[model samples]
Target: GHHNVQRLSTVYTSMGMSNADRGAPLWKEKRDTWASVCDDCHSPRFARENLQAMDEACKDAGMKYTETFKVAENLMLHGMGEPMPKDLAPDWSGQHIWS
Candidate 1:
């Protein structure tokens, strides 16, 4: 079917993506970000050991190690892949916290 073909091709393309080409280095980059947010929002320090342990736990539970994180749609839609927007400022006041 069309869906299976699409999924297969997606898997192939994903397999071909180089480490640098991926938006974020999943385990290192995103997990660190999560650790920072967690420590800030909860108890004490964000230990490297804990993060590594958590990563190990996730892997044991059939989680992925690395993958592409490219925001393709938003990149195309919001002119990120096109010309830069004028006067780009951080609008923290906006109620819609999509970012």
Candidate 2:
């Protein structure tokens, strides 16, 4: 059994937690504080709602969802310029979404 929930950074990143940033996103000890920035870095919501939103955006961007890239690549590709909700990321992922 792996117990590390208090480390919201781990739950948020979906990758694992980091104590010293370690080149990863910064995460505080409070969950409420993180709620604001969670979607920006990465999280379960990203894989869930955010990606779905990106899919729609990709379609709107006149781009097709081809089976050429991994889930991450496709999500990133589709997220570009895709109007994101203010709560999630107003203009955060736009760069990664394009690049």
Candidate 3:
């Protein structure tokens, strides 16, 4: 549970994993290096399985986010969101999609 919370916290504070260029050689090298480190202690198959599980978790999170965005976009397209706040600072957009 701690690892999950830590992973979520890192994801939340960072730029986010959804937009990361994971197919790049640099990313591949990094992943391979990490896998090697993991394999030093665990079996190669176990390390690979855990890494794949983490990847699946990230994909699951991304799908949930996409679904949420679709719902929000649908609400906006149908003009179903709350009215825009008029008293907010000029820099703040509040709930208005048009702002």
Candidate 4:
């Protein structure tokens, strides 16, 4: 799920979209797309509410991730964390013990 979210965020950023753009217009687009296929069996209100709940869950998860990452980042930045493998590069993309 993190991979999927990262991929989507990359696409959105490449399209010149900001995080703030994830509001009614984006939500309505996703809702309408799903509704076109699912509205036959599900009430629009039900689908909308479910999507809204999922959005809230995602927002909460993102906040938690930010908080956790900040702690790890601070530990590394201040040289309080475990040393990285000598063979590995300093970039985030490289394979590491945590990955």
Pairs of colliding residues, candidate 1: none
Which candidate has the highest TM-score of all?
A: 3
Pitting candidate 1 against candidate 2, the one with the higher lDDT is 2
* Order of candidate numbers by TM-score, starting with the best: 3, 4, 1, 2
Clashing pairs in 2: none
The residue-by-residue lDDT of candidate 3 on 18-90, one tens digit each, is 6344445656655665466555567778767876777677667667866787887788789997544777533
Per-residue lDDT value at 28 in model 4 = 58
- 6-99, model 2: which lDDT tens digit per residue? 5543433432211223223443333334444544556656535643463355444433323332454657788853545778853355323432
Alpha-carbon TM-score of each model against the true structure: 0.27, 0.20, 0.60, 0.56
RMSD of 4: 7.8
Compare candidates 3 and 4 on TM-score and give the better one: 3
Q: Kindly report which residue stretches of model 4 are placed more than 4 angstroms away from their true locations once superposed.
A: 1-21, 83-99
lDDT of 1 at 27: 36
Off by over 4 Å in 2: 1-43, 63-99
Best by lDDT: 3
Window of ten residues with lowest summed lDDT in model 3: 1-10
C-alpha lDDT of candidate 1 relative to the true structure? 0.40
lDDT tens digits by residue: candidate 4, 35-97: 455466667787678756755665665567567768878999999998678776354533122
